[model samples]
Each structure stands twice: as structure tokens, then as C-alpha cells.
Target: MPVLLTKIEGKGNGIKTVLPNMSDVARSLSRPPTYPTKFFGCELGAQTSFDEKNDRYIVNGAHDAPKLRELLDVFIDKFVLCKACDNPETDLTITKTEEILRDCKACGERTGVDMRHKLTTFIIKNPPKNPKKSKVKKATADGATTPNGDADEDAGGDSDDELTLRIKAEAAELTADAAIAKEDWSADTSPEAVKARMKAVEASMASVSLAPAGGDDDSDEDGDSPFAHLGHWIEENREESAVEIYKKAEEFGIAKKHNTMTIIAQTLFTENVLTEIPKYAPLFAKMVTSEKHQKSLLGGLERLVGVLHPDLTPAIPKILMAFYQTDILEEEVITQWGTHVSKKYVDREISKKVRKASEPFLKWLEEADDSEEED
Candidate 1:
């Protein structure tokens, strides 16, 4: 029940209905503004433009607050509210079966959305950017830790173990107050338990938490030269993994402080990217799980391949293999991405060439599966 503010823009015949605070409302509703704006246009038979970067949504023709509010109510009932819990805290997920599902973040229940609706089509095209999949730990035969590690396959690619994925999805049981009190919060109510609990409480109540013994902070906010300074620091320090570089990026506070992931992407990868992909991919997967990081990672790669070595387009196949091996980028995402010439990082022509170069590898992926089935 958030307030929707409307402003009439342009002169006379060219006027449009502008929702100035649509982004804020969308943020509160845990949805992208474009989804609802498209819904309004579809419902009203009017044209709508979503200027996401500028945080402005304009719908063609004039509309009063009452009319707009009524439209919003229908959208909320259809899209925002979770069908199971009736809670607005839900994520819109497109299942592997291509069904639209409203996953309630609060109640942890998934309700199917009717696919016949006009709004469902738009939601399908624009999947949610928020990637919040839980991280799982795997123990090796010799007691090793791998963060979604790959299993070597016959055709020079890797896949995740089905058992690991299943075991990782242990059912969640919400504990009640009665259950907690009965268990006494620990196995035994002996002196050792009390002492341990007191120690934990004291640690939690400590005045200031200290950093680990050898941890470092790279925060340098001296005007506009933080990244330049970061570049120099990266050159000086030998970061073995992308995960280490990502941690350094966070420590620099650029992701939070500078509001840019470009610097992190640039410094994270080594000069010989193809050779380093295997070494860095495990960590890279973890970093690019977020939308901002994914964009930056893509942009950084675009600059590297598009600007640095445009002629080395053949390497795109093998380079993408590492990402695919680690399960970082999905096939549908890359295929949809290939159809576009994004100018977010490099020149349109260069990005086009990179996408074109990536086609064979993508096709090979599909054909490989089909070939396996035939065999």
C-alpha cells in the first residue's frame, strides 16, 4: 500500500504520465519498476517507457491518480502478493519447466502463477536480477573444500554432481519456542554447557570486534584516484585467485563506496585470461552471482577481448568453457545475451564480434548433450 506519485510532463498533445517515485515503490515491493510499468501499458493499451537509469517511468497519454492507483491494485493482486502466504516478500522465478512461480521469501513456499496472463509474458522475458542462491560446501574424500567444484567430463567440460545438489537441499524445520525451551538451547544443561554459553554471550557482548591476525584493508577514498591506486596495489600484490581479488575489491569499499564494479573486474583477472580462467573461475562464479558484479565482469571481459585483442575471438569458446564449467553463467542467459550488441562496456561492433564468436561454443554445448543422448 505504498503511495504512487504522478507528474504530468511535456506540452499539450505530447504530454505523458510520469511516475517519479516508481523506482522507490518497486524497491519496496521487491520488483523492478519496468515490470509494473509494462503491465500498466498492456492493461491500458498505452505506450510506456521505463527509464531505469534515470529512475523515471512515463506512460503515454494523461492519467489521474485514481485511475493509476486502481491499475496498481490489480498489479499487486496478480503479481506482487504471494498466493500461498499472502505476503508481498516474494521472488518471481521462472522454473526450468518454463512455469512462472511466485516464491515467497517469508513463508518459503512456491505458488504457481497462471501463465495465460499478459503480465506473465513480460515477467518471463525479464527474469529477476537478484541472484541469492545459497552457497553449499562439499567435503572431499580426503577432507577438502570445493565451492561448487566441477566434475571432469569426456568432452572437455564439467558438470555438478546430482547427489551434492540434493544433499545440499536438506529440509528446513522452523523451531518453536516450546521446542527451543525443551532442548535448553544445547544438548546438556551441565556446568560445561553453562560455561560455554556464558563465554559465547561475553564474546557477543564485546565492545569492538578485531580483524583477523593478517587481514588487510585497501580502502582509499582520496577523491577520484582510488581505482588508480587500487590498480597499482594489485600490481604490487600477487593475488592468486579471483576470490582473493574480489575480497580486495570489497576491502577497497569500491562496490559500496564508489558504486562501481568495473575496477574490481579489471584488476581481478590476470593478463593471460584464457590460461587463468581455470584458476580464477571457481572464485569468479562466487563474485558474479550478483547482478552488478555480472555486468561488471561482462564489461571487463568486453574491454579485455574487444579492445585488447579483437583478433583473438577464437578463444571465446574456451574462455566461456570455464564459466560454464563452474555453473556461473546459464545457457539461456548467454544465448539471449548473444542476440544483443550491448554498449555497456566496449564498442557495439566489438561486442557484436565477441557474441558472434561465442556462437560455436554455445551450439557445441547443445549438440554435445544431444550427441551424448544418441550415444
Candidate 2:
């Protein structure tokens, strides 16, 4: 939540504190920009105007960024965050009783807001719209209605007919003799047969275990690993744009592969990765589409920070936050990644260092999850 403050110059009444990025800040907080702007007005006993057309939020008089930020924090504590889970993912609903309730999506808790505040009246008057209800209504109108208005009855009858046919088919497959044969079935309990089955199981398990290990060893040494080749190409073409890099990766036929993001992460940035992440975020967004890709990208980052640039190892939380903000990483993936230290990505010692540096962010995530579970 970076504040972009602009102090307006002119006469006494014309002078004001302009928050150019208030809308972005409000979006990140999942609150209407007017809510926080009005809150500042109420707290400072000053006038506030929001020119939504131009996305300009102005607070009367000359207020410093620090003071406004502090006030915004107070507003968040009272309005934005859920009381039960302290999660920002809440919807402010004005009940029939004129009380403002925060419905938390994370914990499913409906907690009341203090009605005594000046902002409460404003919130009650201008309640947050529930897009879900409108979407449900649209779906019902589009799919649940018919010209004769008999869609429900027809759907129910079709389902019942399908069920009856399935039941009849299942019944036709089951003869009395077949049922008797199934019930009379038995396995061989002879010692020789049991030993043979055990030996077969052991042989299968041994083969399965050895297969992957041998294949991995061969692929790694044979220079057939897609990740190794992709990383090398990316390192050589470091000056290319993200789109160009992606096109080249597509030519290599590994753009959509799960491990491609790992290669990109490992090769794309240097020690200044914290600043360079935004530049290459699009490449990551394109490659890392699923949980597996996210995990692989994290693995690549583990090597990048933990193994490659140990000085940037302490910046793990910032790196994760950058990825999270850029929409490259998700909360579940990050939480799972932080819970365990694996040698698959980096050596055990380096993995521990990365996880240790990530403790603060991981602790915050754990606390939020714990609070959600408790509620």
C-alpha cells in the first residue's frame, strides 16, 4: 500500500492534500475509496471530495502522508478487517436493523461494526452491493426459465427417468447365480501362494522405486532435462522482453510445462530480483498457471535466493510478497511452501535458511489460517 501524495498549491482554501493513488490503495484493501476518504474527513473534521471520474481523492487542508496513513490504519481496523479472523476479505452489509455487519469469506463469521462511529451511518446509507445475488438472478433467468415455465418439472422428470433407467440397467446386470458366485468367491490361503504373492509385490515395488531414480539420473547427466536447457537459454537471452522470452520458450515446447517457471525464476533475475520481479511478472503469470507451476517457480526461487544469491536470502518475505502481489503466487501455495523445507529445490541447509528468513510472512499466514479455523 504505497501512498502517492500530492500537496496542492494556491490560496488558503485551494490548498489541499491530494491522494492520487487512493483508489489503488482502496482496491488493495478491498474497500471503496470514498469510505477511507470520508473517514479522514470525519477524523480530521475537514472536508473531503472524491472525483471518481478522474480518480482523484482530496482531503481538505494540508495533511501529511504519514498522518493520513495512520488514519487509514484506524479505518481498516474498524471497517475493513474481520473481527473474528482479522482478514481483509470481508463484505460490509447493512442489516435490516441498521447495524453494519462484516461477513468474512475466510472464516464465515458475521461480526457487527460499531454503530457509534460517524462512518457507520454513511456505510448504512451507501451499502456495498452484492454482485452474487444479481449473478444468481441472471443465471436463474437464463437457465431455469422456459417459454412454458415448466423447466423445473421437466428437469426433475428427466433426472428421475435417468435414475430409473440406470437402476433397471444395474438390476439387469445382476443375476441371482452371479450374486451367489460373488458371495462364494474366496482367495487362496495356501502358504506357497501367499509367499508367491508377497514376492511379486516386493518385486513390483522394487522396480517402481528403481525406475524413477534411474530415469532421473540418466536425464540429468544426459543433458535431456528441459529445465536445464531452458535455464541456459534464458540466462543467455537475459536482455530480451518477457513476451520474446515466452515465444522462445514456446518454440522449445516447454512454455506450458510445469518446470519452465522454475527455470525462468532461476535464470531471469540477478541479486536485484526484488526490483526486477515486476519486470518479469508477466512471463511468470504466463508460465505459472497451476499449483504445480507455482511450486516449481518457488523451487527455482529457492535456488535463486538460497543457493545463487545468499545475500538476497534474507529478502525471502519481500520476494514472496512481490510474487503474491504480482498474482504469480497464491496463498495456499505459499503457505504449503513455507511449512516444509525440502532438498528437492535446494540443499537441506540452504532450504532451512530460506524458510528461516520467511518466518515472519509464514507466521502471519499461519495466524490468519489458525484464526479462520478457530472461528
Candidate 3:
């Protein structure tokens, strides 16, 4: 996140609404009536040129208009230059100049101007750029190639359709797996067969991996693969015997990712991990109006732990506490929670509430580390 503070010097032409505080430039350009000018007696009320073809107002003579240039020298002694790159050659024309707004011309650094000083930081989050759309031979109704010479229909739709189909099929199989796993106790099947069948189903599902294939092997591409360990675990624990899959996940680090972890934890609670309290605990302590997802996630977590650790009673609170402090959970999980909370609930609660709630768990983790060192 980079904070840019710029001083508003002079009034810019009001017609170009997007111009950042180039008002001083405009004031300098306007004549005092006694001064001589070619375009005489034309009282400029924000002079703007209309691009009829594009249907947009463009600033053509705002910056270096002859009258404006003279005023700039008289009134404005100095202009605000970008601190990151001290280039005085800044075209304050808001609408037309795409290059300046998109990125810095001098240093090639991305820049945005915020009028105020509060930490309105801009972080550059670049998405993975995929291949551009290739033009195919689009057959017109008359069986002739279109003017653009590109097939408009079924070009992009084909890939999207394929992805949708894959997701739907995967969801259906998962549903079936859940039903089978739940009823394995009453079903007429050997435990080994049940396990084997489940494994096969899981393998088939796993084959439809989400990662884009045939890309350059970029090691620096550090990303969390969304192949849910829970999906794999569900397949692993098809047997009626042993511990439930959820419990094992808790024991292991399955729901370590914070956002997913929070959901899992919430799911566990909803499944009555706390039989002591029939009504679910108030999740999103900072957020007054709770998110339904927080409840669902807690239920999932409870079920996971309950299934895995049926025999040994789980330290539900401790596990929840542990999860809050986990870097994986805090980094991955809380970011999502923050996003959901901010979007659905009050935006203010996201930063303050999440940070406050997570701190206890973080502090507890530090103490645990200290104890281990002492031991």
C-alpha cells in the first residue's frame, strides 16, 4: 500500500471534472480583461471540447492554452510534482490521457492521487493475464464470414460450459459420497470395499483439478491450491470404524487456512460441539449483525472434529483458539472473513474487530512457544 499526498494548488477548468487540483493552472490562464487575447471576450466557463464520435468531453486547451500559460507564470510560481517521480511534464487532462492515469510516464510506477491524507492506500493486485481472445471464422446467417472476420458465438462459451459441467459433476459425486459414508454402518458391505469405493470416487473427483494445465512452471507463483483436504479426508474415512474425518482434520492441520478454518470451526459448533449451549455462540463478536456463513462454517468444523475424535473429547475452545492464532488461518482465513464482513456488514468492523478478536489467539500462541522453549 502506497500513500500519495498531493497539495491542491489552483482551480482547474471545471468542465474536466476528473482533473486533480489543476485549478491554479486555469486561474493563471484566464485574462484580467485589460490584457490582450486572440480569442477575445470569450469568458471561459470551463472550456471543453466535445468528441461527437466517442461521445465524451475532452480537455484540449486546458493546460497550455496561450492565456492560461501567461497566468501560470504570474500567479502559480511552482506546481506540485509527484514525489515518487519528479516529472513536471504532467498532463492534468483527466479524460483523454489514459497513459498518465494507468501508469507513470517517467518512472513507469503506478500512481493514483488522493486529495486527503487518511491511509487510503493503493495496493497493486495483479491478476494472472491469460491468452487474449483469438478470432475465429464467424459464419453469418448468409453463411458468409462477418466483417470482423471472427466467430462471435461458442468461442469463449465452450470453455465456460466445460468448467460449469466439471463443477456440477464434482458436486453431485461429493453429495453421493456423503450419503454413502453416513449410512455405511447399516449398509451390506465389507469395510474394505467401502473404503476402496470411496477412494476410487475421490480419485475420480480429484482428477478434475482446478489448476490451469500447460502453463510455464513458475516457482515464484506462491498460491494456495483450493483442492480441499476435507474432500480428500471425506474419501479417506469411508469406513464406519476409526475416528470421524472432521476430528482428524482438527488433530492434523486440515482447516489451517483461516477463512475456511473459521467456517469449519463454526460448523463444528452448530453440530452441537457445545451441547452445554443449545443456541450457537455469537460469532463475529465485533460485527453485531452476524453473517449466516459464519454459522455454517462453525457447523462444518464441529462435524469434522466430532467425526474424527468420537472417543477422545475434543478441546473445542482450545482448538478454536489455536486456529485464531495460526498464520495460515490469520492470513488466508481472516482476510476472507474480513472481506465477507466488510461487504455484508459494516465496513468499519472488518479491520478493527477482526484484528482485536485474533489478537488473543496470537498472544496465546506466543506464550505456548515460550513454554516449549523453557521445557
Error of 3 at 164 (Å): 35
lDDT of 1 by residue, 176-243 (tens): 11111111121233566445533432232121111111122333343224444444454444423343
Query: By summed lDDT, which 10 consecutive residues of candidate 3 come out lowest?
Result: 127-136
Segments in model 1 whose C-alpha atoms lie over 4 Å from true places: 1-225, 240-243, 256-261, 362-375
Residue 101 CA displacement from its true place in model 2, Å: 25
Model 2: lDDT of residue 20: 84
TM-score leaderboard ranking:
2, 1, 3
Candidate 3: residue 78 lDDT (0-100): 23
Candidate 2: minimum summed lDDT over ten consecutive residues — where? 176-185
Candidate 2 regions off by >4 Å? 1-221, 369-375
Give candidate 2's whole-model lDDT.
0.65
> What does candidate 3's lDDT look like per residue over 205-307, in tens digits?
2221222122311122342233334444434443521124334444445322323333233222322343312111211221111223333343234333433
TM-score of each candidate structure, all chains considered together: 0.42, 0.42, 0.20
Candidate 3 has a TM-score of 0.20
The positional error of residue 74 in candidate 3, measured at the CA in angstroms, is 36
Task: Give lDDT per model, in order.
Answer: 0.56, 0.65, 0.31
Q: Identify the superior model by TM-score, candidate 2 or candidate 3.
A: 2
lDDT, candidate 3, equals 0.31
| Residue-by-residue lDDT tens digits, candidate 2, 1-375 | 656465664568788888888888886666788899999999999998889878988988988888888998899899978999897766687877888888664455689988899988777777774433332233234345321233322332333224324433333332222221111113343567445533432232222122222133213444355545555565554555665667677776767676666667766767778667755554564456556778878887887787566898877877886676444576667878888888776668988889888887666555545555565
Prediction RMSDs, each to the true structure:
15.8, 21.5, 24.4
